[model samples]
Target: MKSHLPEKIYLASPVWLQNVLVSTYGAFEHRRRYSGPHKKYVEYLRKNVFLNKTEIADLQSKLLERTLKHAAQTVPAYQALNLGPTPKLTDFPLLERESIAMNAEAFLSSKYKKEKLITLFTGGSSASPLKIYISEEARQKSYSFWQLFYDRMDFHVGDRKATLVGRKIQEPDSNNPPFWRYNLKDRQLLFSSYHLSEKNVAAYLKKLNSFQPKIIEGYPLSIYRLADQIIQNSIKLSFTPTGVSTSSENFTQKQREIIEEAFGCKVFDQYGSAESVVFASECEHGNMHIEPEYGVLEVLTNEGKIESEGSGELIATSLLNEAMPLIRYRIGDLGEITESNCPCGRASKILTELYGKVGAVIINEGRQAPTAAIAIAFEYLEGIKNAQIIQNEPGKVTVRLVKRTNFDSKSEEFMIWELKKMLGQSLKISIDYVTEIPPEHNGKYCMVVQNYYKFTVPD
Candidate 1:
């Protein structure tokens, strides 16, 4: 996986070039303007986040009542319920992704025009792939909530930042140093998750140091890999960020330690999804608080009963997104709620733990590679029903793939090429064609498993 490209190439590149590209292409390609409602919602959330428990609950109740009334009146899917003037939350039935897919039109509000609707595609990290639509207002509100969270981290608009999400910014087969791009619109540096291999860590570090971002935001797994590399190489960064925000995947305790140690800053972990049904973020005190202004989050057991203070599957109902209201939506994630109050004075519900993807780390030549690297490699390949990576020993890896009807030798060749590009050619890669990929014993489908190397929080 070692690229012949010199590391100095990235360091030698002028910062103005990145700025120019971001200002031109980034602005034209992906530009979003916050609507009036979006700004109002953000301001409201800033005030509400510090409200007392009773006030917060009252506010949520009012929003819930409004959302339910809107869904009953405008959404075709909820019309059959014949909800009364004052409807309880339990009056609506639980909604699954299958139901949404089968009757997507029924979920749309007749109030919004076709032009206002925007379709969003999920990364298929979960069991079900979704193509959901939201109104422009809903999308902006989501962005507003993110801004509110960033503000809590002392981050303001137009701050120099870096993101390590699952964006395919690099060629799968290209072995190069510039595995990142700059977005001038938001002044953000976008890093390619596909190129975060052991061999390219130094190059990534070089570029990141050159950028000197004030905030680093990305998936926990991807950020952890970069932080781990920095620690292992004893790399001294010239610039220090105020905060490191993680989302999309689970932020483990071990990862928090490594990131905090490497960056000399706090790691603010966030738990939210594209569905916009539920949202939570870590406060300055490191307490994970569920934002009541975003949506109604309910922890339900397997029997479909609500739990007050325990671990269970998260069921959410979005109060925003009037264009396509999702009531009693079963967001496929696990969480634990606690009655303990946050000392930070935010009376919002506290989440003791939140679990999403448990991706493992593959050890090769004493260098650890995150499973996200492998996942991003095969993300573009077609005919993959489901894919899993398992590493039981050093220097060897097993790829378990549930292939679709079109899978062939060429598909295997493509996969091998992508894998070798990230995991060096010296390691042995065994592909196992299976009929199905089963979930773990706990009913969670782990995309990556490493039996040889286990990461734990240091005592």
Candidate 2:
């Protein structure tokens, strides 16, 4: 079996040497992700963001045409369709994860050799892990989109930042301080999400106070857990970040509220995928605007027809990533497009609702209930740090919760009452209290889990 030598070496080394090794790797990544055409792409994105809706549509159409032409010419998967020049976007079939995973190489561009392309493994938060390949230029350009969005929040390249994502910087068993490591290249302090707990949270807080990062970015669950610690302890930090950015997880409104209250800043949520298919970011007005230059995001109904508004599946077609173009990829997300214009004035498309994935929906009496709607049960209720609803049998759910000191039986009863109002009173509910709720292997929290999948029959 193939082994990760660097990971083995890092684990064997002392903590100080491990920090050195992490910084070394960080330096290498910094040069790779921000080098070459990254700056040029950032400049283009900055200018592209201000275009009117018509101009944005024209640019997307042109880019989409170019991508489709390249895919039809070079990619084995798309070439099979013989998509003629000037083929409409709808001409391509909907791409699913299974199709890509079963034959990933067929999707690669014949123009590039597999050995030269950069390979990436997704963390498998919403679905099974998938291996994706991209050209070096594609990788760097993908980073450029994020760099441009971060610039809007006054977080520039080389700015001091703190990240609380999936990276296991510290040993899981180590019960000590310094649950983080620094990367001098990007001036980033990488916090280990695995090590976050009530016992070690004070250390995390102290380090955040001392580091004084200009921005904090990470999975929403990790950041929310930290924010919960701060609020529960009533701790005040010495510094306030310019902004707090969250990605890689389904961020809820309650999580955003707690994070903003704890950090004393706005919580900006960015929507993108390792697939590089779609990109969206929250603006100052709190609207999530899709970056039309990055990709075309189309919301489709259950019948597979496109919808301008209302919640439906998100179909994404990449304008970038020429090395392995994915057209009309159903990325397993459910979203709602908005008709109301964002006051921020960016002419790109708007997403008013972005539920994590179709799997997040809970079912009762043959009807699917969005997790967002179920989550409203906890709204305005005190003394609940975290709650997760698990469904195994039809009309039955087990709610696991971590409670604050103020929690009482009344709070539990109120939550149950509120939940039944939406899920139907016939739904059976049970509560399980725990010291804490653990995150998924990828460090993302899933608030809703359905163990049985035969809820909705075929149409």
Candidate 3:
């Protein structure tokens, strides 16, 4: 019998081979052209990041005007509104996920055909699943913005980077050696979030040591787990990254401390969504600076009025993504904006505070489980009005649900199966039916909560 394993798994295999395969596949099959739009956007971002406050705001206003005009002219949803030329930002109605979900085609531009546009989905962080459409140009521009942001830490394209996110690169049920898949095109080592147990941490560390990534990027919790294991076991690595970049989930202060201490580098926390409507990244001085070049972020009150300066719901209008221009889209997240300039001298708007979904760290038999695994299980499920995963004790999880009247037993069965698959089969899952799952006293609804134990990095 012949053994079946990736060539990269072999000790004798050359690393360049993996890179070649990834690049070739991405260019030909994925149709990813990393030159034209990406380069243009990168150049634009490089220049825009250093602009003064007034200049940045002026740039955003021009971009917003163009995007709003384009949306009003091309999109069916906007066309019905009868918005006048040079209409105020408030003149356009606020867009919601439900509106897009109900009629996605109406949101798309008439200029692009359905086949020509790229479809993307975003529900990892929230209950509402949104199906978004973007043009090839928009997709590349989005990637370019990320590249420019990463460049702040001296990271460039094709740099040796490791990522730990929700991608199902490895089989969920399989417990094997290659818990990560190497992407040669981007020179990225994609690690499986599902295989981050105590028994598998050694394998993950071994791969990281071998890969010797110059930069590490992933969800804050996932990276913290790896850092925790390394620090707790006193494991030394062959290489140290320049910095660690985190996104997708809320990067808490404690997680930041542990990651920085363990990796011996600063952690850059980035806040963005799949919608491409708003973007913010941490600067060298640790201030979260909103990129006005990307979008116009407005902190609005519950009554749809803009806040002069304080905490409120985040509503954004994309300066990019003209393919499906979302004007004043309610992002369903809370944050605060400040007029204070960063010590780093960047005059971009500052995000003083962000109160997004900070998922919990569930413990099963002394092993840390990724909250993403639980979050993903509920993705695209019907009749789930809202849900929350609470872990108060080890090996036990309480799922509080605000289900629709039509939610059936089959839905419950599927939820149980999904929970058991990630959290061990021996885990105790209690489904608690509720009329409503309210937010904490601070008015933030954290989907996942872990109260059992706090995993920390030792001095």
Q: Give the Å shift of residue 456 in candidate 3.
A: 5.7
Which stretches of model 1 miss by more than 4 angstroms?
1-25, 28-35, 361-438, 449-459
Give the per-residue Cα lDDT of candidate 1 at 101.
50
- TM-score for predicted model 3 compared with the true structure: 0.85
Cα misplacement distance, residue 242 of candidate 2 (Å): 0.2
Residue 438 local lDDT, model 3: 86
Q: Rate the local accuracy (lDDT) of all candidates.
A: 0.74, 0.76, 0.76
Candidate 2 residues 29-105, lDDT tens each?
Answer: 98889998999989988887778888987888888888888998899998899878767877899898758765779
What is residue 9's positional error in candidate 2, in angstroms? 1.8
- The per-residue C-alpha lDDT of model 1 at residue 350 equals 86
- lDDT string for model 1 (126-173, tens) is 423355678777787888888888987789767899888754454534
TM-score of 2: 0.78
How does candidate 1 score on lDDT?
A: 0.74
Off by over 4 Å in 3: 1-35, 302-304, 363-373, 382-385, 391-421, 424-436, 451-459
Prediction-by-prediction clash tally: 2, 0, 1
Tell me, what's the RMSD of every candidate?
Answer: 5.7, 12.8, 5.2
